[model samples]
Target: MTPEQVLVAPGRRHVYWHSALTVVVLVGAACLAHRHWPVLERGAVRLAVADQGWLLVGGTAAAATWICAALAQQGAVVRRLPQGRLVAAQFAACAANHLLPAGLGAGAVNLRFLMRCGLPAGRAASALAVKGAAAVVVRAALIVVLALACPGVLRFPRLSAGILAAGAVVVVCLAVVPAWSRCRRALAAVVADFRAVHANPSRAAALWGGSLVFAVLHALVLIAVGQAVALPLSPARVALLYLAASSAAALLPTPGGLGSLDAALALALTASGAPGAAAASAVLGYRLLTVWLPLVPGLVVLTVLIRSKAL
Candidate 1:
């Protein structure tokens, strides 16, 4: 076969596979929506009569998340990135993030954007690692602080024997196949990046500050939604519940934490004294502002960026 033919064949296969994956994800989402149609309808009806003012507040907080994400991304590396494209890329990345499980889509988009900005592939990957680590730390810290600030707001659920056993098994399996050298090297690189970023006081501030604010903004979205639905929980309590639920949802490798986050958030709210219907309504409104409302526009941005070769 000619070299051109060989190269074209793989590209064609990749396109076909990507198309198949998109179709599957869309079908899955449709099926999920259908299965939960009754619950969704109730939530929608409740949201229709919810406080519009608070709903608008939730929407504003949702929009700010992308900007905070961009700030954290910039702070991940020492070099400067194009501000406009960085914000645009974060917007597009949010769209991609919901299409794939875990954070793969968002990570891929950011990695590509960084490389396009002239960062080497390794450095780009490390930058992503740094940002992700900072995000985790910030989220965990917020959860602790909120829990403490609002005493008795969050109650940890009891783990079943089966779950405990399963977790132990998984831990043992992971321990059996430890890649110590690779782990050490990756950790070393991340530590070095952390040191380099902290060397610049501004970068350090942006890194930690952006990460902290991003998580807080997300929690604010939930809090506002709860208020809109007239949930009895205090704002501080609602934010604590959101942080706790979302942190737990991260364990499940669902796309943008779709099913997992929704279930966890609703359950947490209910367990924390919110009425079942109100909890569901608040969760629905939160998703509307953060995900559904932005999905189409974000996709358009993604398309524009791709077509313009900006991604």
Candidate 2:
């Protein structure tokens, strides 16, 4: 076989295997949902009679998340790209994200898009890393500010504050430490890229502002869902709970945090005094607006982008 053929052969095989794995994950999620159909049905019923106006607002918020993501992504690099295409890529990337664990699919799609837009591979990857770090930092800051302002909203296990502080420091150090000498160069590149991106005032503002707004919008979506389903918890409480649960769920390696995020959200809501049924309903509504509703269109957009070589 020619060299080209050899390379193509491995890629084809990998694609087949990845497709199979995606199918398995979808089936597993379906089965789990079936097992919880009764709860879901109850929740659905509650949602059916909910305030349509509020639900509309929630849906709008959910949709706006993609736009915010695109803005933040663009802000990650100084390179100018077509604004419309960038947002479309983010929309399509959401579907891609669901097909692989730990955001590999989304990262791959964005990396390809960035390279297509003329960024070098290393720079593209560094840009992505910077965007992710900015997001984490922004979210952490929000959590701290909210937790302090609304004390007792976040109830941790019986651990002292000092212990929690130490644990957080240790975790941060571990995450920041490079595994080997070879990786240090990559780490330094990331730092340099981060500095370069933020050096531009507009880029820095877009990156940080978009990240903060994205988090708030997501929280607002959850809060709107809570209102739609008549969740007993106050809006502020629901927003805080969502931020906490979603952050915690990020630790899981599941595709889209599918099962993990759902469970964590439900558990948090229920724990915060909402009835189990109400909590389940709120989650169902939130997912319906954010995931299930947009999934098909997102996939269609993804396929078109791929076939057209836009990504």
Candidate 3:
């Protein structure tokens, strides 16, 4: 086979697999929606009577998340990326995020985009790690601050002894596991990139600031939805609930935290004193603005990026 053909063959295979994965995810999402149709239908009915002004606010917040995400992605690396494509890639990444569990789809898209933007494979991976780490730190910090500020707003659920024991065992196993040489090298690379990012004031600000705002905007979206649905909980309380619930849902590897986040958010809202129906309405509105509304357009952007070889 010619060298060029050999090079092109792997790309073709990757595209095929990517397409197959997308199709599977779409099918799975459809099945999930079908299974939960009753709940969704109720939510939709509630939303129809919700306050339009608050819904618009939630929609605006949702739209801004993509911009913040793009800024964070750009800040992860030193080199300047094509701004337009970078934003477009983030938009596409959000859609991909919902297509797979544990953020694999979004990560894959961002990694490919970074490599296409002239980053080496290792560096691209390191950049993603840096961005993720920043996001985690920012989110955890926000949760703590909100919890403190809202005093008594968040009630921690009691864990069974078995669950506690399992968690302990998992932590111990992780601590005791010896790292492979390659894993160690990758860790070192990520640390190096993390330090490099922090050393530059502008990049550091963008990385951390963007991460913080990205999380805050998401919480705002939830809070706005709560208002739209006339939820009794205060905005601060709602934001706290959202942050805490989303953090908990992150433990479960669900596509875009779909079922997991929905359940958690509704439960949190209900637990925080909102009526069950109101909580459900809030969750539905949040999802409508953040996920369902953007899904089609985001997918279209993804397709365009792929066709243009910008991803």
Candidate 4:
């Protein structure tokens, strides 16, 4: 190609990428705005009767989730992590997670953080997998414990046997499609990393403990919000409902589980005998504490961390 065409080609490519990124950001913003419009329409009136003390408690729990996330991340790897930077990364990651679907934003931030902390790319990825696996196990255990304690309160929606069979078949087919050698290598890496993390008593404790605390703190936030909004359920029951709803909603691929989680939580709360309006208010309060309130600050912190090369 001529020198002039080559020069213009680079500019055109830049424009194409820039336009693509702009479109993604705008789409994400539009989705958020659409999902939150109902809450905005109701405004402060819905929260007028909420107990300030309970709301404060909810907000505190919401804030603490980030620290728990940081601890869990640190425990995922054996390296000594800078405490302040680790927590700051989590705070920033929260904002980024909302901008991308399926946890990509947060994963990208943490992956970069791990690499910067001196881990190779593969190890960093395996560490993330280990942490995620621990989280899932802890959450599932909590759900089982709660179900056993509460008896009939934990009934799940039914699916047809044929549907279940079909799902299993689909999963098996997908698993079969991946190259056996690649899958084996990936499994080996994950297992090796998992063993390494678990071999250290402190790291194992941190991993399991942080994961459990993170899940419980999130439920506490919901429970406190329920109290603030005068939902009639017991604290234990509210926590159970939150866990169930969140587990169900996690299957959906919305950014940070935005619209899906809200809808699921509201439906679960209402099914548990809460007044529809009260359930809606509780969900709104929970989102206000966890998402909308810290969004801008989180973004700003993310920017600062990026500029400083801390992430």
lDDT of 3 at 291: 95
lDDT of 1: 0.84
| After superposition, candidate 1 runs with Cα above 4 Å error | 1-40, 156-178
Report model 4's TM-score to 2 decimal places: 0.84
lDDT of 4 by residue, 1-311 (tens): 32222222335655566446545645765676577667544534567778999999999999999999999988889888899999999999899988765576788888888877888778888888899999999999999999888778877679999999999998788678856657668779989989998899899889999999999999999899888878899988888888999888777556677777877887788888987668878888988899999999999999999899987
Which residue window of length 10 is worst by lDDT in model 4? 1-10
RMSD of each: 5.7, 5.3, 5.6, 6.8
212: Cα error in model 3, Å: 0.6
Query: Quick one: RMSD of model 1?
Result: 5.7
lDDT of 3: 0.84
* Residue 129 lDDT (model 4): 84
Question: What lDDT tens digits, residue by residue, belong to model 1 across residues 172-258?
Answer: 776567565566666788899889999998998898998999999999999999889898998988988898898887776567888
Question: Tens-digit lDDT track for model 2 on 149-252?
Answer: 77887976798999999999997777777654446677898899889987899999989988889999989888898888789988778888888999997776
Which residue pairs come into collision in candidate 1?
none
Residue-by-residue lDDT tens digits, candidate 3, 192-240: 9999988898999999988999999999998898888888988889888
Q: Which residue pairs does candidate 4 place in steric collision?
A: none
- Estimate TM-scores for all models: 0.83, 0.84, 0.83, 0.84
Q: Over all chains combined, what TM-score does candidate 3 have?
A: 0.83
